[model samples]
Target: MKKLVNCFIGLTIGLFSWTGALSQISIEEFAINFSQPVDIANAGDGSNRLFIVEKVGRIQVLDEDGQKGEQPFLDISSKVDSDASEEGLLGLVFHPEYQQNGYFFVYYTATVNSIRDAVIERYSVSADSSLAEHSSGVEVMRINQPQSNHNGGDMAFGPEGNLYIGVGDGGSGNDPGERSQNLTLPLGKMLRINVDNLPYSIPANNPYAQMGGDTVREIWAVGLRNPWRFSFDDNYDLWIGDVGQSAREEINFISASENVGGLNYGWDCREGDIACPGCGNNQCDEQTFTDPVHWYGPGPGLSVTGGYVMRGEFYNVFEGHYIFAEFARDQIRTLQLSPGRSVAITATIPANNISSFGEDEKGRVYAANLSGIIYRVVEAGILPVELIAVHIKKENKKVFLDWETGFEFNASHFEVERSLGQESFKQVGIVPSKGDAGEITNYQFIDQVYRPGDYSYRLKSMDLDGSYTYSMNLTIKIENNEDMLVLPNPALDKIRVGLPVMQEAGHLQIVGLDGAILHRIAVSPGDEDAIEIDVKEFRRGLVLVQFIGEGNISFTKKLMLY
Candidate 1:
């Protein structure tokens, strides 16, 4: 949800210092079935699991290795107030040394003494590391909010080992109280606190730490309408995507050297390099304000959702690029930061409704949308090959499978896997890929069965780099008694043939290709449904099995004796 929808200008919105064309990227679906998932994060612990924050006050655990737990890692819905569209459990971050301390924190809205407030509480992990011990919650900090729209609920542990919280200006049309520029209040400001000190303590270097009376000691930086999302890169540079009010949306850059606290981001006073449309007098406007590294008018987008630098090792193509998205525009793009703090829109990605972006322990990137789906960003032309058409045919105790791929790229091969009953899937066969080409490729695999049972089969599409994805399951059932079908088609000594349920007796004969009878038997409707034949005395060759019943009714099938 956007804080402000005031698109007053036709916006010749300048995307300050940007290159026109950039490399193209795309997304592959990674996970699904979440409700209004608003944030993503990972525990610094070596577990490699990614935590998904749902807006309704629950955090889910998703493991990339196919071991997702059915229950949420943390569920605080009972204590969270999500009555307003903007109010809810919004943010989560694990302590840097979570493995040792088992500490984590949350930012959410809850009613305390009949007043709504933004609550920051600490919790610990349970013995089962994937879940949290619900009763361990300890209140860290709480601040009353005048409105729900601009809670600015985003949190991260800074390189200095302190917790920084982004608080939006007490929400209303155009900062009625001018809270953003006021350094005396915690609202409309970025606050830094030391959570290591239990209920939390003020950092000695916080801008207003020594200020007395009405001054807020937790205030580190002021003048932000709503810093909805922000991040600190490996370089310790703080990047913020502050939602706009009337005319422009912007991205602010705080380089490591300029991050020594007490910096103002022009919000209510000036929106994106321009003077606040209606304002106060004289040199009060001359107060030094840090300009956005990039800004754009409402013509392009209304709200900006901040992103992280792609520093993951697996996907190195976007090595140093900065990625961000527009909540109202439903688009994701990347910016490459050149020297002098100037950045350009260098790439566009194919994803939609992206409410937030997240990174895993391996630095791999992921994104989640309001529509309950999670996507993984991938290079444009290298998606894993998928089977577009698949078919199965059962004949004489043999299952024949065929499938086709619409396109292939860096494909290694396909593995045919099968599951019997509820057993785990096991590889049955492998078919080498047709190499990297845009043309459709057809492949086939045959699964032999000697016993009749239910079978489920699927393809495992492989990439040259060893990554793989599975196709939907195709199920085929092989029954022992069907017409005059034969089990153990290529028999060394014996075979079973279906017996016809007849009104009278019938003779079952195995006739060789040369018209000689190899075996014979009498089957009646009152007897068993199958007749076993011995062929150990016969030479290894193809033969036909014939069944003659009442009214000249007969069924015949070709069989192989090995």
Candidate 2:
């Protein structure tokens, strides 16, 4: 028995029983225009406001109270070299305890000593919150780049109260200094430091801190190409999206639980588990090397865009999927990876020339296009619960269904369908819709029935603008069976499934909850190794593991890799 609220306007809406969603919402227009919007962040301070960073070194503010203010929060273009597309203000991050500290960090290309280099600067907002004082910008950490191109840009704070920075391999072409794997250089790696210490100090427990060599103690993971973006989930696991050179693009997952530091992924040595012919030595020891859990080649429109592991409170269906985008590929791709398997692509949200993906305080993902359009991803056709309670009654014969259209996009009408059995469904009532809400309108329907039976209902909303979407199914079930044994629920690092212990060799496909295949492995039963797959190369979140044995027995299990 679920409770309903009298929340907003009295709206009658369809019901969501257990499964079946109502609609899929997409970006209708760009949120804010920018010459090049690299990233966006929300205050998370109960303020539905967002901060946008421009490539040319300016920060713009957009408030959710329906207010849009234009004035660079901080303009460093005069101090930065905005000539090159990649040279300007590259990254920005708000402090985890920003409400009190008011401290924020920025990564930019500064012309120091007549040589351009990447620098991270710390700034504090004024007591009035109107502007950040110019003198408050303090030098935190700086890394000198050998070449111009691979100036690793993004910087973020992990859940463990450490600042993580992205560093690309020293520019020019193919691993010139072989710097990605070299612990000495900060290029081409993810570095973490504790900001609680003065300025910033390397965390003592960092993976490479005890290497005893001249390596940077702050180096958390190395052997990466140009890692433009990296983020951590609530569980403190790290997710990295490294832009590939030519052949492939890869995403990585590092579990905080493992505490396995110094994770040296093969960069110039290998791209996504396949040996680079030019790098020589086709076969190398697999023990010391970590392979990418998810990777893809340069398809028609393909370039690795970083995404977020759906950890927001938006909806359950998309709860744990990793959402990413492709620049040249122009698609929002989600990756779900399980232990002992590669990362698999789950969902593909189409867009034109999308460059970056962003997440707000609510955990909703945003896609910004190179064309200067920004679209927030939302549930296409959804209504509030309070709206679902009205006109819904268990009459003697049939249930009366009525719902007021709340937020709609190109909505045509509501076609109510019912099912006694989960399979067979028939049209019961038709409710007409009046397109987009120039203004809200109410609608109703009734199914006159004589016998008492279980039923399920769904809304088929069509867009007069030529689009169609369905709502989550509403079940009035009489009885149901015990849930299937979906083993390895929320698997961490690794997973195993028992299905009569087949002795056949077949292929295995790992998928996400959304039915997107995450990993496909060729396996031979009776092999002792149990197939060693690294999730470090894929995005972190909930994933599905599917195994097809030689006997054609298929098994599916849900897994979560931190």
Candidate 3:
């Protein structure tokens, strides 16, 4: 999660300043539509698949091409209670080691014997990797819900690998039972636990894990009315959107590195720095509880929906701002926090009914609307070039770079920049582009003098009017060993291989797992530095590409065909 602070450049179209100032932001609608979509997430398995959760207890799967699967990944509608507006499937998270274990967890509300309960369950993926094994589900924890509306249903895995769950104050209006201030209850609190075991084990560093005598050991923080949505930033700082009681909506911030947990947010006693009527003598004590970082009166919005801090690569002005929305206002706003705990409004989005926010593995942010639509956050203006894909490969001692663009408008040229380590990138080569093209175009460049190390490559596209923008960066590691470079991995249709000149006199074979040769090609001396192979005929699974040199020097590299 390295920050690209220095990569920001001022272009002729508009100069962006990182200071706390308002910037124009826009949203692009995604192609796929969902039915009351509440949350969206990626599995982090490098498969580039998106999992969308609907409020009616079903999870839909979408591939990288925006095509949804024919069947739902998981369905629990029979066991879930969606009678109320806010009581249904709420959250979903994949295990940090899900690529190996195939384990995932979900939070939902179920009814049994006419009583509603919030249940956290874990399920394993089937052998097909596209569907879940519903029969293998095991309940991890269940809490009885007294009422329905205020059930806080947001959950996420923190950077420390512990699960954090946000709970509401047992669902009455204005402190009827005073559950938030009660230390013996898990309601209206943030809970942390380790799910590596069968039944979850409380983390040893939890604030009240070892405390006995009716104190809930799973409680990490208390005093929340209804935390509808919450998220952790790249720095692991916790941000929550606590819906207020009468006239206020608030956003609270807690730093994971500085705070030791056990913080009281003052729900029944106070509302957003104001004393609650008839609760605890009507005298607010600022020293007793932690106040919200930002709050607003009930005019433009009613309930706040918390969103992620802008760590995505699409916008430079939104790099360090916290983005959130109000359910009633249907507007998205950004907050910038200074070192002295001061907050300022940076930008506003014109979206509507933003129920939740989501981020992919590449840090791209998406907004899920309760109206059954999803939008991706993007910069306000159009770019000179629409880059489709970029690939880099190390061939022998030279590095080859290739990219494709769907369209180009008023384009001038593309500068290929290379960086060693995490330092600033330098221009290595430049490729001229078509001034204007409505069809697909391809370009390539080669760096013949790069050293052996970690390198990153990016394209800086400049327009005819001198305005420019950058494409997403690609990183590749070069080793001293004699390993061929493969491009566009997890490839579709075709793959290109780069080999060293010394190893050109060899035989290359594409072999399946059953020791059957699917394709073979003879390597001759003085052949080209790269070879393109059509893999559309290969089966969709794991295959090995082996090379046998003149001295019987053979090595195999695993290739995934899809």
Best by lDDT: 3
Deviation in Å, model 1, residue 256 alpha carbon: 1.0
> What's the candidate order when arranged by decreasing TM-score?
1, 3, 2
Over the stretch 274-388, how does candidate 2's per-residue lDDT look in tens digits? 7643444333465266776678784422468676787666745456678777777445666667676556555554455666667777777666665454556654434322122
At residue 363, give the lDDT of candidate 1: 79
Which structure is stronger by lDDT: 1 or 2?
1
Please state every model's RMSD to the true fold in angstroms: 13.5, 25.0, 19.1
lDDT of 3 by residue, 1-562 (tens): 1111012112223222221232345555663458888888889999888888898999888776557888999999887888898899988889888999999998889889989899989999999888998887899889778898788888888967998999888886776778887778888888889998887899888999899999989998888988988998888888999998766789999887755678888888878877764355343355388899999875433888899888857758778788888877657788899989999876554455788888878787778888676767665444466565678887766788998876677889998888766456788788999867766688999885323458778788887877666664577876543667665588778877766546347888889999999988988865644577899989999998887887856667889998
Residue 207 displacement in candidate 2 (angstroms): 2.5
TM-score of each: 0.65, 0.63, 0.63
| Candidate 1 residue pairs that clash | 13-297
Instruction: List the global CA lDDT of all models.
Output: 0.77, 0.65, 0.78
Instruction: Residues 1-562, candidate 1: write the lDDT tens digits.
Output: 1010000111122321111222235555677778888889999898788898899999999997524578999999999988887789889999998999999999999977778899999999999988899999999988888887788889999977999999988787567777888777788899999887696889999988998999889999988988878999888899998888758888888888889778988767888778766544233457888888887775444778888888866545577877888777656778777887777776543344678888888877777877687776654333456345678988866799998775566789988888765566788899999867555678889876543568888777788987665564578887654466687888889887765345677788989999998888877765643467778988888999898775677889998888
Distance from true location, Cα of 77 in model 2, Å: 0.9
For model 2 the local lDDT of residue 194 reads 83
- Give the lDDT of residue 528 in candidate 3: 47
